[model samples]
Each structure stands twice: as C-alpha cells, then as structure tokens.
Target: MTGVRWILMPLLTSAACVAQAGWIDEAELELRFDDNLPRGQLKRDIKSDMAVAIAAEGGRGYQLTENGRLTLTMTLSATGYRQYSGLDHVDAGVGLAYRHKFGLGPLAPEARASVSATRLEYRDDGRDGWLYSAQLGIGKRITERLGLTATYEFERRKSDDVADRLLPTVAADVYDLTSRNFTLGGDYTLSSDYVLSAAYTLRDGDIVSTTLRNLPIFLASSAIAEDRVFGRNRYAYKMKATTRGASLGVSRVINDHSSLTLGYEYIDSRAEGGIDYQANIVRAIYLHQF
Candidate 1:
C-alpha cells in the first residue's frame, strides 16, 4: 500500500503541473529592408530608393469567454530612405492591431485598425513633406492557414516644394494631393512558415497646387494685357486621378524570429478623362524578429 501511494502521488503532481502551464506570449524586434525597384514611365527619369525599417512589437492573449480569446499588439517603426542621387530621408510611425477568435464552428472573424504618420526630407533640396494614413479591416479565417480580408484606407499628403526650386518658374506647378483607397485581399498559409497572398485596390485622389513665385513672362504679360493681373499673380489648379492595382506576394519564415517576402505589384492610373499610365514594382523585404 505504501508503494502504491507513492506512485499515485507522483502522478497527481505531474497532472497538476500540466494543468498550470498555459500558452506563452510572444514578443519580437524586427528590422526590415525595403528595396523599391521601379519600372515604367518614371524609371528613366527618377531613381529608385532603398529603405531600412525597424520595429518592436509584442502580443498577449486575453480570455474573452470559455472558448474565445483576444490578442492585442502594438508596434513602432522607424524608416530611413536613401536615393541614388545622394538624397536621404527619415520617417517614424506607430501602429496597433487586435485580433479576436471565437471557437464557433470552423470560421473566426477578426478586425484591425492602424494609423501612421511620416515626415520626408530631401537632403539635396532642403524640402520636406508630411503624409498621414489610417486603415481599418475586417476578415475571417476559413482555416488555420487561409483567410480573406477586406480593408478601407484614407491618406493625405502635403509638400513644401516638389518641383525644382531653381526653376521658380515651375515652382508654382508643385502641388499637394489627398487620396482615399479601398482594398480587398486574401491570404493562404501553406504552413506555419510560408504564406501566399493577393490583393486588389482602388484609389481616387485630387491634386491641389498654388503658385510658387510668379507666372511665366508670357502668361504674366497676357494677364497684364487683359488687365486681370494681381500683385502676386497667384493661381490654383486641381487634378483628379483614379488608380487600380493588384499585388501578389509570398512570404517565408526564415527562423523563429525572421522572415523574408517578395512581391510584384501593377498599377494603372488615368487622369480624370485623360490618358492611362502604368507602373510596375518589384520589392523584396527582410524582417528580423527578436
């Protein structure tokens, strides 16, 4: 009887230990490399840029009910860009994500929202711009490794000097723009370490500009001749454009805390009632998790 009691006590202790162990939380520090290889009309006139970004994020699970759980995450990123013409810029931003899961049947619904702000400075021209964006998304998981997500986003941009400063003649041509975008996407997770995804997006926006210095001599003279010249000769112009695009990508988890992704994107834009413009982009991203 004494030997049996000893064996039973050990078995009970092991069970208690197992019951106390729960899922572990995750935290990581990520460093990312973004290479924007440009193709199309802008390729010959503009140089491509490279950016390095770093982020730190953590996630923890909370019990919502007997069979439901929520995961909350917050992240901050700093990105710096270098252009081929020796131009450089830096931007910093923050974001938050929340995911909830309910153990009902085979599908789980999730929602997410994020916002960020960026400041861009041109090293050669001493010019800068501010850009801000917010996005919200809702999605459902079809399986542990597959899902569909739909999102809406709004973005606004303002710039100080986008055109050549030396050519103040065209400086008035520099402008600011605001855009609103809607997108739908799906993700297919092949495994714990690999995923493939695609998305279609539509963007509509308007560009606004004010006079920088003065109108060209010919236009100025014409205005003067017409007796419509003001002291400053200021003018405003508005342009509207629509863009549609698709992206395809694959991501691989290199290790417990690292990932690499490659993607291709195509975009077609047309000025309101104008000609169409096409752009192609190839990008490679490396992320490090700590």
Candidate 2:
C-alpha cells in the first residue's frame, strides 16, 4: 500500500491547487457470461459461469490550460459470480489522468496518460490483491463520426502468498501478476443514437490456469495452489504466457446521459510447455452519467 500512496499523493495535492472545479460522475452495471471462467487448458476442466458487476465513479477535472486537462476519479465496484463464488469481489480504486491536444479542431491529435491503484477483496482469501496500472495513449477524431485510439499499459498485481503444506517451496501467490499489453480501438457513429466499436489487444504476461493435476503444467508452474472455485480436485498454476484478443460491440444511446452496450470478446492464450486455452465472453453493459 505504501507504493500506491506514493503514486497518488502528488495527484491529490494538485487537486487542492486547482482553480477550476467541474465534477464528473458515472455509474455502470454489467452482466457477462464466460465459456471458460477458469482459463482452463483442458476441456474437462473448463467451467462456464455468469457474473454481474456494478460500479460507480465520481471525478473532478481541471482545465490546466487551453489544451491540457487533468482529472482525478474515485471508484467502487462489486461483482457476484453465479457458479464460481470464490471469484466474487469488491473493489475500490483511484485514478489520475492528464490529456493534451496538439492543436485546435475536431481532427487534432490528443495524447493521454493515466495511473490508477485498486484494492480488491475476494470471497476466497487467496485472490485478494492490489492492482496498479499505468497507461499512455493517443487518439484522433478522423471524421465527424469516426474516432480511433491506441494505448500501451503496464500492470502489477499483489496477492496473498499461501503455501501448500506439501509443496512449501512452490510459490503460492498465483494472483500476484505483472503484465504489459497494447490495445487498438475504434468507434464509428452509425446513427445519432448508435455506435459501433471494435478493439484488438496483444498481451504478454503471467496467467493463472486451473486444471486437473498434470506433469507438464506442474513442471512449468511458478506458483501452485488448490483452487476451490472450479472444483475440490482442481489446482491452479501460474505460468508465463502471451494472449491476443479482439472485441466487437454496439451501443445504443438511451438519452444524453445514458447508454446500453452489447459486446462479444474472444481471447487465445499460449503458455509455456505447450499449454493453451481459449475463452469467449458475452456481455451487456448499461452506463449512466451525471
């Protein structure tokens, strides 16, 4: 938590120095279904599940200059999983961001940078963690109806280190993870009230996989633990992996301050020692801004 404080203290101080004050608030509810909730590598280990999450955030933005703005946000969220109750969690986070426009006009290129820290508490103690992230992005409005964005992000997660009694030497903090990823996204206005969105992402990092006991994964794992979320006999292993994914979505504006979105995402991950997995997710989200 000390590291998280060092990153956020400066931003909090800047908020007191700001002369401009404008509040931004938003709330969101999401329902999702995952065909591979466990990130399982074997068909026998795959566990499908559905979840619901709700979140709210409020922020203040300061126009530091004609083309630069700084914003700070605080957020709270909770999620409930239908089958994997251990994955249910509550999260609280704070974010600070800055954006600058290179020139005036709707077509001007913009650059953004942000940092955030979140604390997540799970029903299962082993999954409890702190998540930290930093990102840099660029965006441009190519036309009145089209916008594009690209971003690179670095993330770190910290979690409990509960060692198995039999494998005391094995690392047990499977949720303590680190990753770097790049994303490209675009949005096109289809009508006055509808938007079409798409995104592609490439990620290289550590991933946790749960499956029946196997020698290949057991040998490659940096961390190992019994994961009751899937089944009593299932075990979780942490391994280095690379993932590529894409998403497609459509959103309908309900009014000036609300919208509903339906989306689908597919991800393929390749881990060490010839292990691989794929996941398909369907989601519906509703958001309102105040």
For TM-score, the strongest prediction is: 2
Residue lDDT tens for model 1, 1-290: 23223323443344335335522122222222323222112223222444443333444657766654455544333334443322333343444444444446548676666676666544334235777788888888878778898999989777665443333343432335678999999989888889999999998985332232323322321111111011133333335667898999899989986678887888776553343446567667776543
Q: Candidate 2 clash total?
A: 0
Clash count, one per candidate: 2, 0
User: Model-by-model lDDT, in order?
Assistant: 0.53, 0.86
Mark the regions of model 2 whose C-alpha exceeds 4 Å error after superposition.
1-24
The 10-residue segment of model 2 with minimum total lDDT is: 1-10
Distance from true location, Cα of 211 in model 2, Å: 1.2
> How do the residues 1-290 of candidate 2 rate in per-residue lDDT, one tens digit apiece?
23223323443444334313434377677889999988988889888988877776788889999999999999877777876777877788999999999999999999999999999888787888799999999999999899999999999998855646348678777788999999999999999999999999999999999998978988888888888877778888999999999999999999999999999999999987898999999999999877
Stretches off by above 4 angstroms in model 1 are 1-83, 96-106, 124-127, 160-175, 206-238
